[model samples]
Target chain A: MAYNLWYWPGIQGRGEFVRLSMEAGGIEYRDCAREEGAHALIENMATFDRPPYAPPYLELDGHAIAQVANILLFLGDRDHLAPSNMNDRYWLHQVELTIADMVAEVHNVHHPVGSGAYYEDQKEEAARAAKQFREERMPKFLRHFEAAAKSNEGDWLIDHRWCYTDCSLFQLVEGLRYMFPKRMKTLEPDLPKLIGIHDAVAELPGIKAYLDSNRRLAFNEDGIFRHYPELDAA
Target chain B: MAYNLWYWPGIQGRGEFVRLSMEAGGIEYRDCAREEGAHALIENMATFDRPPYAPPYLELDGHAIAQVANILLFLGDRDHLAPSNMNDRYWLHQVELTIADMVAEVHNVHHPVGSGAYYEDQKEEAARAAKQFREERMPKFLRHFEAAAKSNEGDWLIDHRWCYTDCSLFQLVEGLRYMFPKRMKTLEPDLPKLIGIHDAVAELPGIKAYLDSNRRLAFNEDGIFRHYPELDAA
Candidate 1:
């Protein structure tokens, strides 16, 4: 059965994590918002009697699943993108949740004061927030992920097999590099394992094809990981 | 076997979500951080080879599970705090995840600029953030929850029985009321179903006793829902 994935059309926001996982797993799914228009997405979301809080919901067998990590959790279990064992699945989930946390932080770096406020209005606060995110949080999260990677004697984040966490991490690294080129440049050498996983995921047949295609949206200022030169430093 | 829960000592922070679930479910778990000192909590965390991103972790049968929603998902399934059917479980999980989203947003209202910076340092930004939260987000989330409640012909967020989502929603209402009394007072009249579930959850035998006991810590500035009069409106 093909999955109906609904997200905003233009930019790869949190939805990209789910998309990357599907693409990597070779799962059958349609980017509903992209194929249709943004208006169709909103109208479809409204049709759900108990609609999700936001976009990036997956509709399968007439059931709508929301939340990036929650969606990944379902897809991971279904597509075997998560570990076979339940215990390991939870561990992989922990990493996904952490990635979600970092994603939220990444968005805050641009709109620090509030999501309702314009980025220009909160530029000063964004700079302060971005500094903490880049200088302190980025390194800390990368180190935490690195530690998780090293704990297992494999290149993957967990076990020897690739999981959805790896795909999400690949996106996280790509987004971070685009948003904070200088900071990532300085930190890349120290985060060899994370960098390795990012590179490895990029090489996956499905992901490689998808990334090379127009299906993969380019990073832009409109997206979560927006590039603002002022927000990054070496 | 009893489970061990590790979280910060003071304030009903994120840990409260876990505590409320265990309480409502009548599950056996020790508040590790509360019984042991804060230093002990840190020392214990250091012992984990694959340490969690942060506390509010559950140590069960030598395996540690972190992330509030992840912990709740495990405990919900274990203690039957969640629905038995797989679809309802996912639906419950979706609501729980949405509640988690609001919790993150709630925390952001206080630390709008950055978690590293003091609230006092970013009071102006927080004031702007809190206004949007109190006026727009508070109503939006509550209305969305109310719709969820109305969708099912049940009082609980999911099935007729009390699920872990109810407990988290209870905490959300309690925290929001503490953080924004005037705002909640104005909005509560329009949110009967949410308030009804909040009241019903409190009436649960285990939860009632726990709230009365010292196990349920009081809300304070140190916690996610800090009551700053400036952040609220009538």
Candidate 2:
């Protein structure tokens, strides 16, 4: 059955993680917010019996599932985007949650004061956050992900098969590159496995098609990963 | 089965969330780090075949589960700390993940520049982050959780039964009170349901015993929620 995905229209944000997974799994779903405008998304959230704290919720068979990692867990199981083994599924989820943590950290680099404040307002704090993120946090997170990838026999995080976590890793690497080109360029040499996953996910026919199509939103200042040249480092 | 939990000693931090659930559920577990030391916690992490990105990891049977929400999902299901229904489990998990998000934000209030940087070094930035957290983020999160508690029939988050999410909510409120007593005093009236859950969870036989025992650590500056007078507003 087809599902409805709700998120802000103009920015990729966390919604892009869900979008990439659905696209890669060839799951049938409607990008409801993108089609109906972000106001519809806000209005739709009010109608949910179980409201999400934020956007990027997925409505499946009349139930709304929120939280990017939770939604991915549901879709991953239903669409075979996760491993069949139960333990492996938990392991995969553990990795996804860590990725989620890193993503949150990435967002905080640009909005260290709070999301309520504009980036321009917190530019000085953002610069400090960015330096710490680039110098210490990014490499630490990348190494953890690379180790996870290395744990399995193949390039994927689990059982040598591409999964929802792989799609998310692809998006994460892409976002990092967009947000900190100079930093990413410096770190890429050390993240061969992560970069490999990114390259492989890019070549997937569905993801390639989505990326080339107008449906894929460009990364901008409004999104979780914003590129301010001043925040970048080498 | 007895499980071993590895986390930093001398701080409640995120590990308290897991400890509360297990204690409330009467699940058998060892606080390995507290029994040993922080160095032991780090050393134990190295032994894991699939290492956790950070602490508060539970080692069960032969496998280790990391990520507080992931570990709670595992324990909550096995020990009836979550609803029996599948969809309700997802809803509970969604709330827990949101709680996790708020916890991260709580930590960031003091450590906005990076976890690597000291609060003293970032105190100026922390003041700004704390203002936004106390004024904007805390209320938004508390309201969402209060709404979740209200969505159910009782003081708990689901099916009129106490779950791991309830324990987490109790801890969240406790941490907030410690971090921002004046702010919580002002917001408490609007969070009747949330406060009710906190009071109810606090009164649980298991939780009360744990709180009275030496096993329960006091909230401190070292933990995720830090009390800084400069950060609090009424």
Candidate 3:
């Protein structure tokens, strides 16, 4: 069965989460919106069942699935992105959803006034958002990641088992490093366990291969998480 | 055993979504956060293998699950909140996640400046935020509902299945109507099937009783979705 992934082609956006999972699991899928063009992207959006309030939906068989975390869980379960043990599976999703929650906050650091507004227009608000995000949210998310690491009793979220939470944490650390280089540079030291998880995630065989290859999309301003110089503090 | 639902005590917020599912299913559970007091909510937040970034988590049989949609899906399947068929189950989650996306947007409407800021301070921004929400989001969401209605070969997203999607869609319409009355008044006429679904969900034995009961929290100014007079317009 061929899986069709539809997202704004230019930037990784939310599609990247599902992409990372599919790649890690070696699932074959097409980037539909990229192949079809922006017009097709908008047209497909109009056709979706709940109509994604935004981009990054996956089309399986004929049905389109939106919401990034939901897509990840769907693909994860299909290809073993989480633990099978009930508590472990539940914990894995909590951490993943928390990552999603953090991603939203990271996006808000530069887009506090609404996604429709440009960064330049909201820089003042973005500054305040970034400050709060950097000081409060970073530690909060990292603390959660650290707790999960401890709970797993080793490195990965499920001890010896690596799950989608790891891939997502890899993405979170990568995205945060891209968007807030100086901030992350200073903050990374405090969350040693989270950093260990992030570093370990990068070295995973499938992910290592994917990142080294052309499959990894470079973080750009066009995506949900973007780096703005004024918003980042050293 | 009994389910232990954890969430913030003061507001309907995200916790309400989990509560609705439990209530609709007629499942017995404790509002753990409420009974434990605000201090316990904070204490619980601090303790976890993977601590939730926010509340509205569920402790069922020693496993904790967070995220509004994930919680709904977990409960939906276990408690028959979803259909037994593979296709309908897939579609049901699609609808639930989409409702979650809409809920996120509704949250952005008020917190346009950022979650850290006081809404009073962001009223100017919230006005602009609410404008985009009313002009763009409400219709877009309504159209999605209309299509889902169209997809319903019979009534619900799946003809014979009254799943969590129906309950959530009912809540979305209800919340949207409460939060954006003037806009919904205009949009409702065009979304007949959605309204029908909303009415159908309202009449369900479980939901109908919940709506009339005191256990159902009233929508107030402090929730993720709110009704501010200045923020609403036709």
Quick one: best lDDT, which candidate?
2
DockQ order of candidates, best first? 2, 1, 3
Q: Candidate 2, after superposition: displacement of residue A48 in Å?
A: 2.1
Residue-wise C-alpha lDDT for candidate 2, range A129-183, written one tens digit per residue: 9999999999999989888887776777777668999999999999999999999
lDDT for residue A69 in candidate 3, whole number 0-100 = 75
- All models, RMSD in angstroms: 1.1, 1.1, 2.3
Interface RMSD of each: 1.2, 0.9, 2.6
DockQ of 3: 0.51
> Chain B, TM-score, each prediction?
0.97, 0.98, 0.95
Q: Which pairs of residues clash in candidate 3, taking residues 3 or more apart in a chain or in different chains?
A: none
Q: Please, what is the whole-model Cα lDDT of each candidate in the order they appear?
A: 0.88, 0.90, 0.77
Question: Which lDDT value does model 3 have at A132?
Answer: 75
Give the Cα-based TM-score of candidate 2 against the true structure: 0.98
Model 3 over residues B155-177: C-alpha lDDT tens digits?
77676756777777888887888
Q: Candidate 2: list runs displaced more than 4 Å.
A: none
Candidate 1 CA-lDDT value: 0.88
